[model samples]
Target: MLNLVLFGPPGAGKGTQSQKLIDKYQLVHISTGDLFRAHIKNQTDLGKQVSQLIADGELVPDSITIAMLEEEVDRNKTAKGFIFDGFPRTVPQAEELDRFLESKGAKVNGVIALDVNQEELTRRIAERHKLNGRPDDDAEKLKKRIGEYFDKTIHVLPYYEAQGKLAKVNGIGEIEIIFNSLCEVIDSF
Candidate 1:
């Protein structure tokens, strides 16, 4: 199984590359943000908790996020592997994910972090705002989300790095160029 964690700051093409990775690798894509949105849309018990935290621009606690991810993972018993996007944002969560996956006899094969600088991320997010009209894409919220990644999410890189499972790919280029770069990393594994 080729379990991968797609790591990066906001607007770093994680989502776009995740799709290509899924198509080529035949992996299930488990995006926590998408899962939270679905739960919130359905007004499930977990969604209620996540909705309030998200509205305040806060991350849902690790326990809740882990449980939600485990449920999703459990549902896909026959998946060849999984691409975990927008998850394991903190080191503790990374540890938890490792433990959970171990319980199921799987492990994270690699972490491909799209290394886009803040300036380019801002530009891409701004363009995404105009294209999608996502509420969180507004300038202030974008700043916060990006800040959170720098402050919190980046820490997880070292965790995977220590495990020799990290591949830092340049993330400022044409879509196919970046995807090709990511494909190189995946193909190596």
Candidate 2:
């Protein structure tokens, strides 16, 4: 299985690239953000809890996030592989994911970290906000999200790097260019 974790700050085009990866590799795109939205839309028990937290502008607890991911993994056991986006946002979550994958007799084959400049990310997010009317795309929320990404999530990169599973990809170019770069890296594995 060619399991991959696509890591990057919000607005770094993780979602965009994940779609291409899914198309090219036929991998399951397991995005925690999408999962949370699905749950909230379905009004599931976990969804209700996460909805409340999001409504209060709070981060959902790590345990809750991990549980959702575990459920998804279980549901997709027959998948060729998984491309994880917007997940394992903390060191603890990364550890938990490793353990979960190990139990399934698999491991994360690579972690692709998309490196984009802050200004470019902000610009891209602003453009998205204009187009999508997403409630969480305001400047304040964006800043807070990016801050959290660096403070809490970036540490996960070193953990994967130490395991020799981290691949850094430049995320500042055209969409096809970035997607191609990511594909090259994944193909190397």
Candidate 3:
């Protein structure tokens, strides 16, 4: 199994590249943000809790996020692999993911971190907010999310780096160019 963690801050183009990776590699794309949005849209019990935390610009508790991720993975037992996007944001989360994957005799093959500067991310997200109008895309929430990534989530990079499983891709170019760069990393694996 060729599992991957697509790591990046909000507005770093993780979602766009994830789609291309899925197409080329036939990977199940498990984006926590997408899962949260789906639940919120469905108005499930978990959605109610996630919605409020998201509205307040807070990270969802690790336990809830991990459980949701495990359920998604379980549902796709025969998947060729999985692209984990917007997940394992903290060191603890990464450790938990490693343990979970180990139980199934699989492991994360690689972790790709999209390297985009804050200014660029802000600009891109501003444009995206105008188009998508996702509540979390509002300026205030975006700031918080970005701060959260830099302050806490970025630590996850070194965890993988220590294992020699982290690769960085520049995220400030044309979509195809960036996707191609990501493919090179995955191909190397």
Best by TM-score: 3
Tell me the whole-model lDDT of each prediction, alpha carbons only. 0.92, 0.89, 0.95
lDDT of 3 at 18: 92
Residues 1-189 of candidate 1 have per-residue lDDT tens digits of 889999998899989989988999899999998899899989999988888777666788988999999999999999999999999999999999999999999999999999999999999999999999876678888888999999988999999999999999998989899999899998887
The better candidate by lDDT, 1 or 2, is 1
- The stretch of ten residues in a row with the least summed lDDT in candidate 3 is 48-57
What is the number of backbone collisions in each predicted candidate, taken in the order shown? 0, 0, 0
Candidate 1, run of 10 with poorest lDDT: 49-58
> Model 2, 13-121: lDDT tens per residue?
9999998899999999999888988899899998888986664445689999999899999998789999999888888899999999999999999999999989998
Q: Return the TM-score for candidate 2, rounded to 2 decimals.
A: 0.96
Runs of candidate 2 exceeding 4 Å displacement: 55-57
Residues 74-129 of candidate 3 have per-residue lDDT tens digits of 99999999999988999999999999999999999999999999999999999999
- Candidates 1 and 2 compared: the better one by TM-score is 1
Q: In model 2, which range of ten residues has the least summed lDDT? A: 51-60
Ranking by TM-score: 3, 1, 2
